[model samples]
Target: MTVNARSGLPKDRPAAPAPPPPPGWRRWLVPVGVLITLVLLFLPGMGRGPAQVDYGDLAQQVAAKQVDTLRLTADGTITGTYASSFDGGEDFVSHYPTGLQGVDDTFLSQVRDPSVVPHFQATGATGSWLGTLLALLPFLLFLGFFLYIGRAARKGMAGGLGGIPGVGRSKAKVIDAVRPDTTFADVAGYEGVKRDVTEVVDFLRHAEKYAAAGAVAPRGVLMAGPPGTGKTLLARAVAGEAEVPFFSMTGSGFVEMFVGVGAARVRDLFAEARKRAPAIIFIDEIDAIGQRRGSGMASNDEREQTLNQLLAEMDGFDPATGIVVMAATNRPETLDAALLRPGRFDRQVTVPLPTQPERRAILAVHAAGKHLAADVDLDTAARATPGFSGADLANLMNEAAIVAVRDDRTQLTAADLSQARDRIILGQRQGANFLLESEKRNVAVHESGHALVAALSPAADPVDRVTILPSGMALGVTEQMPEEERHLYSEEQMLASLAVRLGGRGAELVVFGEGSTGASNDLASATGLATRMVREFGLSPALGPVGYSSDSPQYLGGEQVTSRAYSEETQRVIDTEVARLVREAETTAVELLRSHRPALEALTRQLLEHETVTGAVVHAIAAGSTADGATRAPVSA
Candidate 1:
């Protein structure tokens, strides 16, 4: 279906009008003159013949009165139309050496009588440097023409003077000399993704069996996931397993400033791929060119033209041709519908964040060259990194190695891995031990608030670790680790989470008599979750089963132009509900902190002394265990 670039709507095809012919005689004038000049420059001796006649012989001929017509030129060359044929033509000329005393006009006039042909007659100018240059002009023009064509063909021009024939040809890199050294084995985890791509490789390897079974091969495969999830690596693994040609290009590489250039590149790419059957063409970051047509305000004719060409090529290719198109995009939702159709990118292999086991495998793969101490456990590291992608895991291993090097140790220890995880998650510790005593006390109370609330709330995730030590953008952190990844959240759990987020502010207000900016991050998080609960999750009674919030792409972030989707009155109600949810959660946190002031003070003292505390210690303290665990502590407000 052809889409209108402006409206993005499909319509009936209209025949294109013929282009008007160029106007005026001037259009053909330069070419005609050039042709004539070329012919004249190389024309066989118009009125002259080549002959090495001696000057004395010419003078004898003139004295014998054999020369009828004599012509003298400005350069002192003399030509005469012979009375009878001399060489092959009627005319011949010889240099009248100017070395002698100035030419004798009377003697020259005597060469021919005035009655026959005028003596000392004027002739065309003799050959000089100017004439030599004119003679080479045609060859020079031809050389320049070829050179321009070569340049244009080699590096596609952007149009205008740079316009060269075949400028639309694709700049796609052809990898024929070197095959992908990476196989599926080299890639860690993503067993499902590997299985998906492996089928394509299998089809390429044994096409005859599938053909006999009456199965048509998938034309294209799309790997969609977050960035650095091993999409490109998986495509390379497919290429390696198949062991065929791989044509690699990015979506941006197709388009040029000139119109139709992108379309030409798409054509050229497929043509090249078709020539090498059983080949894989991988396009990285395909969202750049594959976005829904006519969706944006600006009309991009070049990009649309390229997309049309790509669609045509994908539809035109035979599955049996052994050409598979593979593409990777972090934003698959943005791609055009035509591109994701069954005949195009029929297979979509989603590469999600690695699971705990997968992360362990990924760590092991990246840890191959590194020396790990006996205490360093991949399982423990994997458990610490839940939402980490494959790339993140690889980076973790690299950072751990760096940490080991910084400590001047040859082997990576558990501490190194833990520090690396902290760096990756919370960022590097800032200000180190530079906090003032009062600031340290404040930070301790702030984090203690969060840890205490999480421990007291039955539905909240357990605090993994808490510290008053400043890191990155935060003055302190309260890290929570879920025992198992939870896909669904209960209302009570969400409420508890919101309360925990507000715990720090509630704690500060209770002990210090006022809240501080240190709880700014916690407030923001709690507010957002409360708003989501009311507006999106339909958890608010006032906003009852209605979603007023914008529907944003889950992974890509940001709303997709969705508005409030409700009346002003309903919006007010939503705002009221959101505020109420946050208030209720904050009130619960305040009440909980007020009831456990003794525990808060004890935890704050521990934080100020240790600067960091584990969730186990917080749990024990919250359970009424003494600081030394020998005596029970009474909880008092």
Candidate 2:
């Protein structure tokens, strides 16, 4: 259901909003004109007939030039008869000497054509005017037909009224405030974002406080977040909270193949926003219009015009009138600098990924009425998920309920929750994907290394699940469930985490004497984590606590701040450091494996049959190494 522009609350008795008017003339007139032209320029048909002749009289005329016999029957009908030197085919042998050859008197007594005797007395005839007209009509009809079809062909080739290329049109969606479902309560994990945005809403709700303080309220709020992180939702929530007319649309909505449409729409939007005065304008994914200009040879004049109008409108607005503009985008890097500066988008708020505690809270929100069994622990579930966002948490709850329903259960079980986590992170189990037994064994060993190292390290996160089932990229995943929600990770903790990642490839080298290409994801992850450690965190021997990113512009338009975070002389050292970190962990694992080879073999056998085995199962086997050690139990149900 769509929202109402004037009211923030869900409209109990919905208003019949007027439908948007039809699009530009290019959408219809061009097509209709082509159709008319085609009909007007069409082609027509032609037919054939045989030659008419009279043989007896023609031959006689040719033989005797002067006494030419006429092979004519009275009333212009004639029949043929063969003879020497020409003969007259008279209707009833004319009473005079008709210049007829082989005329015999016996012929009259032999037979008589009964009907012929009556018509023998008649003579003389005219012509057929209708037939003559028909014989001359084909050329003009054919000319007109060709003309019509040819015109149609030309129009079809042109493709548009003006015959322009690149008919790429942007989508249009407008948000109304009345039917909006998002509230401040629906948004999760973005406290800073919420606080900053709440102020904007407050400014919209009560402008006198800010104005009286001589601190003019923000003209525009730029919400920056990755996709699916609810920047759009927050914008709607602002309108919902403020109780004002909200004009919501997308950045792409204004753009068109015709150059000036975007700029025109920008002017129209702000004009309407200002007219409404105490109003809010929300543009979701506004970067489509605000992208950096002059990056390539193509002119950004169209976008520039649109942005210029937007900037002018934003700057020209009176603070007392209470017009708040809000826009959201994932790529802040791509936006124009002028749009992000003080007067235009006066404030920028970011909504990032949810922390563990936030995930638990989000899960609780979704799990409220679902029969999630008293034994279901959201805290544990949250800890089990590391990179989950608000949307992911919502899906996790929904998927758990689906699993419950599929299992024909009245309440969601711990096993169901575990399965939900698996489905959310890895993927649904494919029953029969192909894999050689040898390759499967190798995958099992590789993932086992990750789970083992993660479990063994005191600094590492709690191990969640290890599986050989493939998803988007990795063939297997070793999910590490954290002990609790953590605000930050120490430099030592980050290093250990890197070690855990390398453990997979390390184990491959330890056992098989060489690493397979299966470790591509692992290597990429390790490299990224290590790079951040040096460049961002300044944890390298070559560099001090001075961050390289600090010197780099917030807009990232500048150059390098150092001669590499680590130099060519240090490249080998960094590689050695990384390799040293990896090797030490591998040796530890290999020694551990050597001591508990039997357990590793048993677990690998179990994985081959199950396709997925949880952290609890692996921990059980590892803990079983001791005669009296307690296994890490599953989250109880």
Candidate 3:
């Protein structure tokens, strides 16, 4: 249903709201606004005395005496009157200005008693009863509206603040009908991932290949990748590439906080998918319901039950039937191994971060309709982003265009793109993080050393940006963009890049003869990299040239393989090797600092003043660097 943003009403439903009849309380508001406005308008003149008489004692007195001949003064004060029955038109010649107070209090003695003068004051009151009712009209209208919505939610028309009991059973989205806009062109890099997905797409597109050949095509492919790597999008691309129905829904959506519903929903999803033969079921974030059993989740028993149902349906795949399943999740380790066995998932494809060329392609695709400034170099932009994924690049383009729009520019410039990049990567550089002079100096030196060391290393690339300004998660950041995109890295290059990760700490220690905690992130990054090199890359002498564990998702996904990757002796050797790398890199950075002390001071001073340093600026000092590192769901239409 289409909704009208202005009226907050359903476009198709055209409700005849009875002019909302100035809700009982809505009537109160206008009178309230008027009353408030009038109070504001009239209260200021409370002391002003008007020429009009506020006291009407004469009018009362005349009425009490039944004086028809009473006269009103031009000053609106009572001046003349005489209609005393006792006087019988004799006209009493007694005179003083005729105010009711001027008469004697006891004028009529007893025989046929009559009363004398009285006192009067004109009282002003505003906001009649009708006006007050109108004033509160709006409030009453809103109350009725919310009540209607609340009731509707409870009755299951629109899922209430809490869904109706049967809602969990109805959560699966029929995706082939959804037909997302993503195709293969929308995805880039990860050729290995594409190759793995290609087989599945081929099977969906040509069901006869396996049927005629007496071989079964894979029934499912589990997409396992780190966050921001476009796993969900890859699923959409597969759907776009295939000539079958696609059903997409998140794994988490199947498991509501409500109990017993997850298992029922899982069964329902597969049953529905099966009915749509030659269909693709893409469940993004499958780990939500696919976690290992006995994880102490309160619903572990039920969740595992849900997993069992899902595995059974996935397992009993009949190629002749033409139904397939694909799921995406970052935490693949948590899933049940039974769900990912060869007969079930059969394959795992890893969608990775885009290479430089791929990033440029992604940028171009996103920037297609936007006006570009002459200074916007696609190569430079791609190089400036080393770790950005396809989604990040797309977001960068969107942010740049937004900046251009905000600044009222006809085109997006390189500087605008760079600013947008920083905004996306580090968050806005807020002015609120005021730093002391000493702290500022220390941060500048630390970041500048990172820039210089990366630039000086042959394995590392030139520094793209170095900034001392604070962002969402950091006091400062130094970014290094690659010269070109790289996939495979040499052992030397990896080691060199690791050295630069230690450079900031090295500079702090060498310059001040001690170090601060500014190197926390860098230390963690270096440590993890060194550890991976040992455990996975076989860089440690204790474990050479072979991965001890089958960490590959093809075999490891959903499995509960708890054995250590290496023996205790091997772990000690691995730790020593990592420490040796860190210590050696520290020594190298210190030596460079001692030799280029003057230049180091200059760079840091410049950073303090500018708050940002460019790649060219860092290259001018040092010259090296390297290292490394969705899905429409458905359409109701």
Best by TM-score: 1
Which lDDT tens digits does candidate 3 get at residues 1-637? 1211122212333445452243488578777978876775566578733223223443344446633332232333332334555334332212224555654444222102334322222233344454775688799889967786587566554234234447557476675546778888877667788888878777666656556898786878888877888888788788777767677888777766545566667667766765565578888899988887766524465566667777877774323245678899888888877877898888877676777887887788888889998989998888888888877888899999888989988699998898898898788866845777888888898997787677666677667789898886778888877666777888888877887888898889878888888899988999888888877787767667865553443334465545575578877887888888778777777776666676688788879888887766666655222221111112111
* Candidate 1 off by > 4 Å: 1-167, 317-320, 548-562, 626-637
Q: For candidate 1, list the clashing residue pairs, or say none.
A: none
Worst 10 residues of 3 by lDDT: 628-637
Query: What is the Cα-based TM-score of model 3?
Result: 0.61
Model 2 RMSD in Å is 13.7
lDDT per model vs. reference:
0.80, 0.66, 0.70
The lDDT ranking, best first, is 1, 3, 2
Candidate 2 local accuracy as lDDT?
Answer: 0.66
Pairs with steric clashes in candidate 2:
3-179, 4-178, 4-179, 41-148, 41-149, 42-145, 42-148, 43-145
Q: How well is each residue in 104-184 modelled by candidate 2, as lDDT tens digits? A: 333232112223221112235434554554565597578866675465446552222122332322233334435477788
TM-score, each model?
Answer: 0.72, 0.65, 0.61
Better of 2 and 3 by lDDT: 3
Model 2: CA > 4 A from native:
1-177, 189-192, 317-321, 401-412, 469-473, 505-517, 534-536, 542-573, 595-602, 605-614, 620-637
